[model samples]
Target: MTYLLEYSDYGSAGLLIPAGLVLIHLCALLSAFHSLQHVRTSQAAVAWVVGLVTLPYLALPLYWVFARNRFEGYREAIRDIGKEHDQSVTSIRRELFSEPCNQPRTFQSPLAQVATVMGTPVSQGNKYRLLIDGIAFFDTMLWQIQSAKRYVYASFYIIRDDQIGKRFADALIERANAGVTVRLLYDEVGCIRLSNRYLRRLTEAGVDVHSFNTRQGWVNRFQVNFRNHRKMIVVDGRVSIVGGLNVGDEYLGAIPSMSPWRDTSVQIEGSLTRKVQAVFAGDYYWAARADLPEADWQRKTDCGTTDSNDPSLQEEPSGLGAVCTTGPADERPRTSMMFSAAIGAAKERLWISTPYLVPDDAMIVALAMAKARGVDVRLLIPSVADLWAVYLAGFYYERKLAEIGVPVFRFTNGMLHQKCVLVDDSLTLIGSTNFDNRSLHLNFEVMVAIEDRAFICEVEKMLDRDFANAKRSNGSNRPLRPWFARAGTALARLFSPVL
Candidate 1:
């Protein structure tokens, strides 16, 4: 009553003033629904609500106005939402990052036959193998590209035109000239530093190329933030490759930029490669000019390999390496759910490697809980992060995780960009999705989950190398700063959700 009276006395405002606040609140509620209705599941919708309620009263909006308003990804969308007159920061900004955009055909449908021949696992016949470091991974990729007979589909968040990229491009062009259908997709923002002429050369060489959601205009700028971060390759519908590796010398450790880029990737055979192709084809159609036929092609060979006596192969498990894509197009991308499942299923240890470290609160809590359960949870991050604010946020979590007994390691080499999470000695997750709020809820991303023990073992081997080189962040290594740094960090934290 005192507050009401004070408001009334200050400006002689009438009862109608409260109605205005009520109206604004109502509008916020409605806008939140419209923003999140298209998401895949109820949990995502709930998250939208939670963010709307929690952020508007905080300083996040003011922080976002300065930080993300100028980013190429959010400019157009921000403008559109602002024009709505009642849009909140959360409603206007949060973007879902999941794999639903590349919806696959049913497992047992007629499409399964063609998809199976293309390396998509069908029913009970998937096989997966992991390649740990850039050396082995690069060699394997080169061998496969050289052996291609039909078509090649490749996509990556970053495709540098350095030694490794040039090598891959050369092999791809060589195969394209040999009558193989070659298509390549790269993220515009991820490749922003490279010259436009760089990709034009690929086009000139007859390799069909497209960029994911890239455009330059006043109205289409929202698409820029929705990057395709997946690194994948499907060869001739019989084999597929995916994980954290990108086409760069850093990834191969051939360039001196970083001491060694530690990463994980997998080779899959059986029917699952078709699913990868299906997702890639969706991206190709949406971003490129060509329209390939989606007709169900019968499998030319059985995806299952029952014989263990082949000279080039040995006995393995009977499970087909299923391709799982997570992105925003689904009712819920459920990438977080997939991670949760992997973390929960961990037996011995959980090893993670990521360039970025700003995860949502739930993810942090999940990690803490895992540590509490006696799971050996380790995180490998860059000692010198590209962005200082993001680096501080990483430091913020260091104290908490360390207290919980989760060991954190900082790579002594240059910046690490690969994002990977491995559990026990087998299960692994590799793709474009980061453990940050932006990648979890806003960006369009994809990842592949593998359960093969051999693949996990390879990932462990590579992780061991990274673990050795990483320097521990003792809570007291860097001197504590003055008030302004803490204030700046606080401000950054306000907009961390969008950052």
Candidate 2:
């Protein structure tokens, strides 16, 4: 009778523990169901479902933290804000349409199609100078900021609270104190380590500062995957700078170990500057929920024109460019479509350079098709990556492309971080968007597509130099690894949907 009572008590206690576990699992299943409806990719949805149903204890929290697909409330907030500024957006659109590009007939159709997809038209009479490294980029950027007479709108993905960052902050503060309209936007996740003191200094100096908060509302409290990866600076509605370089001492090669940081940026003046400003305006409104002053749309008649004797106008009037801003807020996946379009349009040659090369199925197919059609395809990626998982994941895709006859080059010299695409000798795509899943579907990105033969040649020459320094590989060059190392890479590839 005693043994029977003891056994019954143990059984009841065990039941209580499993009953609680069952309830927790049931809740996890409910969350997994929610994920199935919102996850961006089918593969990701299935993965979450299986993991949640089988290993709910571990997968549930990860799903909540990192598996958010769409940016909840951001689109709605953008819509509401757009409705409030419908007049301004419409007016800007009208102005963009009024100033048509004088591009060659062969380039006009494709450019127009891209413009339609991006909702920003190609503008002509724009002067462009390619800044090869951080030194040139920051020097020119600081000069532009100092010369700001009306307003300065600046945005960056990573703004370190270091020496270089303080210089940038001081310049902006100086302009702000001088009564120029100055607004600064930084990504909260990218600047996660930024000190409060740094931002406080800017705010105290009368600079309008805001973070691109990915998790801003109740619905988005756990959604932290989306990021604003764009780096742009627009000064006085006349000069605009955009590219891969962020504000940091490392970017300037101040750190002896990470010296010789390879990056690219373009400085633009003329009609295209206004379009860049318009891009800034949208982001500003999204971050601050306040409307920026209407931009001055008056075109500089002598915009890209410079006297032959004048060295300052050396980069004048060389190309026509359009700004493409894309994010999850769009009803359609415009960035993916844009990449496909550029790839499909290439007939002669296609060259690409990006730090990350974990492309999606669509991109892989596009590249394969391009090769099938007899187009020369070349890809440049970092030989030594800063992110270990991303580096390993890149090898998986690199092997796939190499098996298909596409030559992949691993940059030998420092870390190559520039994002650029060259199609034939006409189209150049340069900006923050990388050839990866995260950039294509999740992050908010910007790219400037320029159609100009002269500029394209310069970019080609620059890339040729990069290719010369890089080691060409077709997977055979990759060193043999142990089973565990290979397995790690395969696992990283599996998570490419989120990476």
* Whole-model Cα lDDT of every candidate shown, in order: 0.63, 0.82
* C-alpha lDDT (0 to 100) for residue 414 of candidate 2: 80
Candidate 2, residues 295-414: lDDT per residue as tens digits?
A: 676644332222446554455445677888888776788888888878888889999999998898889998999999999999998876677888889878878998788989988878
The top-ranked prediction according to lDDT is 2
Off by over 4 Å in 1: 1-127, 214-221, 254-257, 294-320, 403-405, 474-491
Q: How accurate is candidate 1 locally (lDDT)?
A: 0.63
As for model 2, its CA RMSD to the true structure in angstroms is 5.6
Sliding window of 10 residues with minimal summed lDDT for model 2: 96-105
Clashes of each: 33, 0
Residue 453 lDDT, candidate 2, scale 0-100: 77
Lowest-sum lDDT 10-residue window in model 1? 89-98
Q: Estimate each model's TM-score.
A: 0.69, 0.88
Q: What is candidate 2's TM-score against the reference?
A: 0.88
